[model samples]
Target: MREITTVGVIGLGTMGAGIVEVFAKAGLSVVGVDGTPELAERGRGFLEASTGRAVAKGRLSEEDQAAVLGRVTWSHRLTDLAGADLVVEAVPERMEIKRDIFTTLDGIVREDAILASNTSSLSLTEIAAATAQPQRVIGMHFFNPAPVLALVEVITTLLTDDEVTGAVRELAVRLGKKPVVVGDRAGFVANALLITYLARAIRMYETGHVSREDIDAAGKVGIGLPMGPLTLADLIGLDVVKEVCDVLYAATHEPSAAPPALLQQLVTVGRLGRKTGQGFYAYEKPGSGVVTDAPEAVGRPGAASSVAVVGTGDLATDLVDRLTAAGTTVTAVDDPGADTASLAGTPVVVLVGGPEGSCEDCGSGDCLIAEGVDPSDATACECCHGTAPEAWFGAVAESLDSRTVLVPTDEPSAWALLGRIDPEVQVVPVAVHRPTRSGSLVEVARQIDGDDGAVRSVDATFAAAGFVTLVTRDRAGLVVDALLYPHLNDAVRMLDSGYAGAADIDTAMTAGCGYPQGPFAMIDEIGADEVADGLTDMQTETGDPALSPSPLLVEHAVANRSFLG
Candidate 1:
């Protein structure tokens, strides 16, 4: 609750020095500590070089840089933190080391002084429990390159006081970083979700479902992430990522947090990251630019071709848009009525319909067909027979007979279609259910083709404006739909459990965690039937109870009476 003018930063490795530089640049006098004088001086020098780079880049004035640099005093003694109001521990992640540091600090700092940890992994509660003043302990998790990445996770232990929590939140904002408050669970919000997602990505890569390059490409292009997960792992230092995963897995007992074997082996081989000149990608010696081939010496698979989408709808449309923008191709489909087509002939199809309609039911102009009624808008179909899709799939199969069919529908339709399709046919189900952003479908197709003309192009439609694509082949949910469904369910669970509200959860995700939109809002944007279809597909695929459609979602879909509307 006290105003912070003087702060202490414990440990001055890369993150620590960055933290120190960040605080001092904000005009706070910082006491930066290390285990020894040599280490303390080294940490100071690291901060100087970083600020010097800023000065050279004209990002900071010389006078301001010097003043900022002047504010940090290096120390080898723990007691040097005695006069500071806030102490942020950026120590190595070993629990013994952190426990020792906190126990020592408990005797040195004032009772009202806030003791915070920059631990991205490890339990905030456990760290706090090590000290006599557990109420004063909290988490101020700064992202890597702490001076640059703008998000901070403000974590609280069960024993942490409300005033301390509020103070840390205010401090984060004052530092020009967006902060989201979370309980002291392992990995907090960002890492918990992010690491698990990244782990899944690795598993996907290992399983050969997608290549490393395409996996990264998928997150960057498919999920709207700034960088691919593998590239991020390299930059963060694979060893560090492993350590974080180990801590998280140990604490949460969540199997999802367990580090992949490939990640650990890379670290053990001394291929840490940019620091070691190699990782998922090799780096330029003495610099951070990545080299893609070093890991092939250890059996890394070469990249996969970025997925090439063939049509324009909610799914293929965006595929055309993203692929073209990414410089791939967008093939146009001339006629859905044309028979004798193979998936090799079409490769993919975007089946556009409302919830009540089937591919057979939808009108010739890409509209929904419900019973005997033909509707132009396919966005709001609410009919759910659980057997209608089978009837429709059979109709579609009979219509296209003997030729391979690639059906990209929402989860329910996909599941129904999957059951009806003959196993011998070549059917590839893709999940691409996110909306289109500002750009041309012509451009998105170019990106998908990626300069491989020999890669064969067939019928492709590039619908412009207000036409978005959802691309998932034969699953309960396609890529975007499946990704969003679990999170929406999690959001409902979070609100129902009193962890956060709709607005706060939305704010936390959009502002604090970098999601494009909050879960509930996205569901509304996507439509209830579409979401239900996705969940239905997922549950069918995994037979997992967790993937089942929520009663709330079903209610909304029924009341709306249309997914396309």
Candidate 2:
């Protein structure tokens, strides 16, 4: 492989300047080129401002900052790249503009010099087709704020030489980047999955399924993402997100890739997210991160004063403690065998365990018994005979008359148990796990109630029970798991398909998205079999191929071996 010493960066915009800084900081001489002297100077100013901030924050000494600045030379002429070992084009997302630049660079640069495009979602083949030396052209796609991010996608087209790919990958490693080699597909790996997820969030918002704040909260608290999809879109600039969505949709024709109507409308009105101080949420100012919300048009629903907590074990204990701490009147009944008379006047009831018995034996007499039934009446002991209490509708008929019931069960069981309840009873199925982050709340499947105010009341009840709430539709995996499991399954498929190794895929997601752990690591932590089962169930419900569990995942699950092990 040829060594890369001097790098030439064209179109010194935000991405271009960051790329130049990354190379310069790695001790490579960089020629930052732009369309004119003014743009070149502006790019230089951006570089100086970035370095100055670093110095002010004590991230870099003054001497080191000066050295980084000294290594970069700004110019307006493409001919200045004649001695460059590699030329990276970071121009706008226009095929004609990029083709023109690559064509000019082909004539100006040395015969062996590599040419790369820092495009997030454009076709490398089409860009290379404009040059005579197509075999030398590849993609070195970097994440935004390239100097701060570590992931570099090295895209290889059909005509791209193996040596050229290897050289670029090596150069990325030398510049403190984790490079993953991928095919020249639209959005590649990260953005392909990311765009689909973002589109789903927008659809959820547009359809009035959940509030914007709760949706964002779900992503942050449920999964360990650095930011929610909408907030990230705002930070990324909605205009750019729309463009990428358009490019992906045009390439794959996947409905999930199409930009939602709401996104387009926001862009049309010039409310381009944080860049323009408005998008999904209002920002303090243009390019600001601080967010503020106007007073909600509808007021919050009233809170419930009294709640009955039933079932046994740690989950029940936690719920009782939380409810007690929240200052709500809590009637704690650990014995499911207790008469329903104790739960008569409670306005809300939280069932902690699922339909199946919470104890070790199936015949454990822990089911909720009716008030007037004799304990020895075999006919009325359906719960002890492996039937859920909700199945015995007559048993809880009195309790359900005027009260709201909250069942915190697994996603698959939520619907089945909820379906058995009387239609007149207000029931909400919630998937509650131990909080992943501090102050994170449980996810409430709100479609069961079909009223925003009713859902809010349930949310308030949960709050009174000492839990935060994220309201979502009564979907198979709820919000967090629905978006999260499919992405993990996709990562597994990527490993199974030989696109990349487990370690590399893990590295890519963590470095690319600021996730606390990569997909494989999460799979191992969650148990391979559990992850596989969840994906299989989701796939069956949604019919999305992305949700299908990889065969490797199934095999590992069957063998009870960790992916990492």
Candidate 3:
């Protein structure tokens, strides 16, 4: 492995400047190069501002910050980088520009010097092809605000020398980064899965399936993400997101990788997210973090006229409290006296118990049976009797006159099954994983018979119950789980394939993307077997190979061992 002492960073943009700061702060001599002296000076200014903020936050002493800044030499000439042991190109996404710089550096730098690109989506092979020493070229991708973020994806092409990749990976670790090595592929690992998930969110917004706030809230509360996908895209800049999506789509030809038309339209109009003060949601000003609802944004749901709460459990109790707070006329019937007739006049009925137990007829003639419970089984009446699909369908069928029947459960399959029971029945499956205060609800639409009004109304009713309603089509995994399971499966596969260790991958996601938990920790909390089963079911339903459960996940699940263990 080659020793890395001095580093050269090309292009002095936001990413480039950050990369310069990272290397300098790591106690390395850094040369910041740009196309023009003005750009080089601007890059210096960014570094100064960034370090100044650190000083203000008491993270770095003024003397230490000065020492870090003093180590970086800014210049416009490419020849200044000739003495560097490694040159990381952080130029724009344009291929011509990146290749041109590589071609120049190929002649200027020493033959043994490693060349790397900090591209999020571009092909490493194509970029390496520009130089005569393709074997010496690899990818050293650093997340945005490189000094603050700890992830560094060390990507290697087929032609890239193993030693060069290893050297870069080791150097990244030495620079206080968590490095993960992957093949030279579009979007690498993080963006490959991330772009697909973002595109799905964008599609949901474009089709008016849900509001922006709900979409973001689902990510935050449902999966414990630090920010919603749309919000993150805005902070990242919509144009940049679109560019990465385009690159991934072109490379894989996957529908999920393609940017939605709405995103393009927003970009075309110069509404490039927080950078331009407008995207999915409007920001207070350009580059501002304070977000206000868009002008035509749909307001939160108002109080419902009447809603009936049936069954018992924590979910029921939470629902009752939220409904009452929303000023809805809550008709709670926890006793055996309350029956089908008790819920007859209520437009919305929230059933909390599983299939089995029967309640006295609320005057509707038939017993009020919980869905998915077996009424024939004498033990089914127990409060803990699991939810039975047949019982739920039967209950909903008896209450056919009710405007909406809300089934609160975390099982996506239950939602899919209930939605299939009767296409005409307004069966809205709700997944409330987080507490009511988190304001996250996964609302699955089992069937949309062109009646957008009815669907929106049901969504509003639930929203009024203090749940942030994330609407999605009737599918096995719905939105959050559908996207999340597959991504985690991929992470497991990466671990299994030795692309990266479990700890490194976890550190990369948590540090790089601000995720509350890495994939392994998530699987542990949700149960590895449960996650594997969810992914298997989704794959079986959608026939998407991407959703196929990983063998590693299956083995760990069967053995009951943690991924870390």
Candidate 4:
């Protein structure tokens, strides 16, 4: 309960040393212990080097570095932590190893001192049971690069006392990290959802559905992730990923977390990632883990002179922006009033929204239109939208005699469109490599131009990931608004079902799911009507009573008149 002036960090590995550095910089004296004095000294050296790097980067002053390094006292003996007010065990994630350390700490540290684990995959309850005071044991999972990555998961087990949980949350905030308290679930929240997603991605690759680069491209470009899961796995070390997967699978009994065959093989071969020389793709840069390929490009001389982007949704807007960015002339039009002037002197490509239907130029594969350069080879409804537009696009592309490239935004849509497209039509989904601040294709194009890179290659990456298509697909729900609405409605449903209070549900999801905002707050941010429309779409698609739009959602959507409202 007292202010933690002295802290003990057991085990001084990569994560351990980082933890020590974080605490020391926070002005807390640290007793960092390792198995041997040599290991302990190495830990101290890592701390010094990390702090020195900060000083070199102007993040920390020279004096501040010295002060921070001076705060940590490396020790080989467990008994050295006797004077500490708090102890965080960052030992290798093994039950016996952690149990052994906790057993030792129970005898050495003061009875009142709180004990925590930096174990990401291990059970907090089991670890706490090793100590006499199980109430003090909690999971304080700091992300990799402890001092830099902002989110800290504070896991509270059934046995973890509320006061201990509060203290850990306070400590995390004190260390300048965003803290979210969670229940002692397997992989907690982020890892549980993320690892499963990663496994599926790997499976998708292994099945030869998409290339490794394309998989990474889909995640980085399609979803706004800092790093693709493959790259992240490489950075974290493939061995560690495999181990984490094993632990999650063992704890949760879920097959999704079980490491896929390709993942295991890559780890086994030691092509771990940037750390190794190879992974999903050969890393041209050792420390940075950037990927490159020089395969012969395919599908040249396609007939796509000018395009008409139909629909006024976000997808259509993104398409207009992207097509313009790609140096292709584009015109946006509603069904009733088609602007023929915009299609002047260019072959028109119709981009339809929602499911495929009777196009204005149906049955006529080639609608001849007189222009400056002979009659144009007309392609009716170049693309379509919906949950699985890619299948439709794929089907359409396969049959086209003239070469044309059809782009789909996300996996479902792309796959749907892909099904309908001709096999010969070179399909390029958006797959961005670099980090993007904005999800919009227009912004990404600007970012590509602003940064020093081959514009053609960057454009290709966008095309590969389907960013060129501009329609973002929802994996769980049908559309963005629809996909998110049920979750928010579920939060409200939780309130109605007496599962938890509104604030508590929000708190849990924020801490538990890494949602930027809670469900109710999200409804306001995303607009109630938008959510309602999405739900209505989902309800129509699935015919599930549960998916029917909530009354509150209907009220809010109509009242606000916008999804964001």
Candidate 5:
């Protein structure tokens, strides 16, 4: 393949200008084009503002910034790109406009010159087929603010030549970007997984299974995302999100890719997210990230001076540590045989049960009896059947009064335990999820009877302990696990279909979409067997095929292997 020294970038919008800056920063001669002179000048302003910020931040010297700008030759004409070896069009996402540009550029650039598009959605194959030298056309999809983000999805159509893709891939490396080669698939790597996940989060909220606040909190605190999916949708513009979802759904016919009615309605109402100042959330104004209506709008939590924790393992141990560290007097019980007499006087009683945090065999901790198992044939896994959770819960409940708030940690059916106790002791659903860099989160399930004293006390207690708290409804998976596991399954399905390699998918999510960890890394960190089991259990509950574990995930989980390996 010929060397790519001079490059051409068409379209001078935010994305287009960023692409121009990327090439110019790499010391390549660039012909940055636009449809008109005004847009071209505005494009220059984009370059100036970006580099100016870098200089202001001391990350770039004024001389270097000037040199980077000096390498670009601005133009409004297609003829100027004739001398360029690679010309990437960052025009609007309209198919007709892109096809016209390619058809025009087909005669302008040389036969061997690579013609690439920076489309986030739209078919690269159709665009390539519009040109005379189809083999030389490819997709060079760069994430927004292209100069900053490290990922560049290098997409290849069946018509694209191997040399063309290779040259583009090498060029991406030289440009200081990580390129993940993929077939002509909608949303490609980063977006395919990302949009699907976002859509699911929206659906979850729309279904009222979880509130919007809880959904976002679940992603942020529960899964350690930088921002929640709804927050991201607002920033990305709901219109764009809907548009991409439409394309993905059309391409794959997957239900998860279908845009939720809430998302579509928001777009129709002109609440196109932060751009309009109203999407899933109301922003301070147009084009602002500051939310006007914050989720944690509630007043200070009701205080709990002393709490009693019952049961054993990591769940109870962690709770005890956090509560003690917060200065709340915690009466601890490590052994199963420990007395429950102390649980009677405390303001709250936190029940952290057996080997699985609750009952071992029972699903969702909803009942002492595992679903589908006969009462007579219950498993001997002491937690569910024998002298385990049933014993501790009965003991603790027998001692506690109506005044004491009981929180069954990670249990969905904490309310059901009301029968086990004599008094109407408010049972709150509390799930202490795994801790992240941000800190641990205690998920509180909203009580159906409007009993919030338990919620506030649990919130206050966990908050004082320096841990975040999110209140979701009493549903399966609470908020985090329900939304997260399915998205990982989607990534696995992508890998299973050979659309992209494991490393590339991970790279795309981590580098392109600003994820803390890739899906595969999450599966490994969360445990493959754990994720697969979560998906399987969720599938049985919701009957969503998308939530069902992929055969690959099951294979890996059964073998105790990581997807990265």
Candidate 6:
């Protein structure tokens, strides 16, 4: 009800200090309190260094920076916040620590002063109930480097007053942030989608389905994300990522939301991402982003001389064009029987689940339709798209005698089609996800049942043809789709629950996680019907309930509607 002037912030860690910087730079008096004088002083250093950087960057004048510094009164005592109109706790994410801070602030700050928790995933309802004035308690979650990132999740519990929510939203806008007001749900919006996706990536790596570099690269190169999930987890601190995973899992009871053992083990050891200098990737030192680990040696690009492409789809056509431009003799035919004589020596490419035109920002194993490379080959069609073509299979593979069969699919059914081939075929299960600004990602299964020579050729050929290539084990969804679809499902579920609108969720992801497009945008681009069918197929293959399509997704698919519209 009153104008907010003096603000008190508890805990002056990286996030806490950034919060202090945001408010102080906005020309408001701030009191930043930590547990000890030393920690409090450390918090001061964080604020001063941040402001000093801004001055150096010419973003902030030295005089204004000094004034900003003048407004902040750092302390180790809670009593000093008596005059503050609002107090925000940025303590450790543990419940007891936050509860203690809220209880202390309830007794210290004025009754009208709003109490907010800068928690990423803890239950705001439980945190609010710790104090007598639950109406004033809310969640003001700011992403890391708070002064930089524009997303602030303003969360409200049932007890949180509308005025409290409005004031926080107003302050967030004043501080130059695009705030998404969400209910008091675990992980709220951003982390709910983000952390679960990160957990899936971790599980993929843990199972040795894909390499660490490739996992990061698939999302970065294939999906056009700023950083891959594993890289983000490392940057955010694995411990923090794991904590949020626990919170989300506790709330949803979804296995995908739970932290993988590898993540927990890494945190147990002192490898807490860039902070400790050793996380998924080896960094130069603590707090450094420079990765010191050697990238896996890949086959030289453009190694293959001749290939026969026997598929129909935009992705396959793109591959044919790129490969042809790279000087590889490509024998591509829409009819499998049309080019059967030339398929003996050349590698045969069966493009499965191909859409003539798709959303520009499709991601991860997004196979929508089976292009009739073998128009009459029902087995290949039925295997990938779950529908039989007019003609049965085997015409495409009739000539290949022990030659490499490159079947790019969204699932492991590539092997199914190749298995039906009578001859001894070296099946290289290829996975495709296209949505990059510059290139696409072609992921292959590591040589288990697949031929090592064929795998090596694929890496060389796809990479040389201007695509990101990753070779991993023959997992159900390969690399990209394994982490992507479930995340989209989570977004759909979140939207269905009415926690946050689709536009707000999209903004949160784009602004907070640096994704090229949010989940809903991606779904609309890829087609809801196709995505739901893909999920259904993947769920049938894997039997993982996490892969099941959200009912909202199915509804949208059935109606041919966009999640955004």
Best by lDDT: 5
**Ten-residue region with minimum lDDT total, candidate 5:** 375-384
Tens-digit lDDT string for candidate 5 (48-127): 99999999999999999999999998888999999999999998778999999999997888877889999888999999
Where model 2 places Cα greater than 4 Å from the true spot, the runs are: 292-301, 336-340, 354-408, 411-425, 447-454, 464-466, 489-498, 520-565
RMSD, one per candidate, in order: 7.8, 4.8, 6.0, 9.9, 3.3, 4.8
- Work out the TM-score per prediction: 0.72, 0.84, 0.78, 0.68, 0.91, 0.86
For model 1, the local distance difference test gives: 0.63
Question: Candidate 5 clashing pairs?
Answer: none
Candidate 1 residue-wise lDDT, 1-565, digit = tens: 6698899999999999999988998888999999999999999899989999999999999999889988999999989999999999998888898988999998999988999999987888888999998999999988767888777788898899999999889888888887888887766666655666666566556655445665565555555556667877777777878887887788767555689988878888998877788877766773566574733422212111233232224544444454456443345442333332343433334443333334333322123223443322222324532324334444444434333334443444443343345554434333332433322211121123222221112112222222222221233343434445665655554555555556655665565445676666766776677677667867888887766776766877779653223
Q: Evaluate all candidate structures by whole-model CA lDDT and list the values in order.
A: 0.63, 0.78, 0.76, 0.62, 0.83, 0.79
Residues 398-475, candidate 6, lDDT per residue (tens digit)? Answer: 556675565645432342244346547766667777658746788877756666777787778777777778887676
Clashes of 5: 0
Q: Which 10 residues in a row give candidate 3 its minimum summed lDDT?
A: 356-365
Candidate 1 lDDT score at position 278: 84
Per-prediction tally of clashes: 64, 0, 16, 47, 0, 6
Q: Write the per-residue lDDT of candidate 3 for residues 1-565, one digit (tens) a residue.
A: 7899999999999899999999998899999999899999999999999999999999999999999999999999999998999999999899999999999888899999999999998999999999999999999999997988888999999999989988998998898888888898788777776777787778767767567776777777777787888998898889999999999889879676788999999999999988888988887888898877754556754335788766565666777888898888898756543345546546666665532222322112122334464443322223334333334434444554535554545342233233233454455656666542344564646555535555566678777766767667777777677657877886897688776677777877887887777889888887798799889888899797867798999998889889877
lDDT-superior candidate, 3 or 6? 6
Candidate 5 or 4, higher lDDT = 5
Q: What lDDT does model 6 reach?
A: 0.79
Off by over 4 Å in 1: 267-271, 294-492, 502-524, 527-532, 544-565
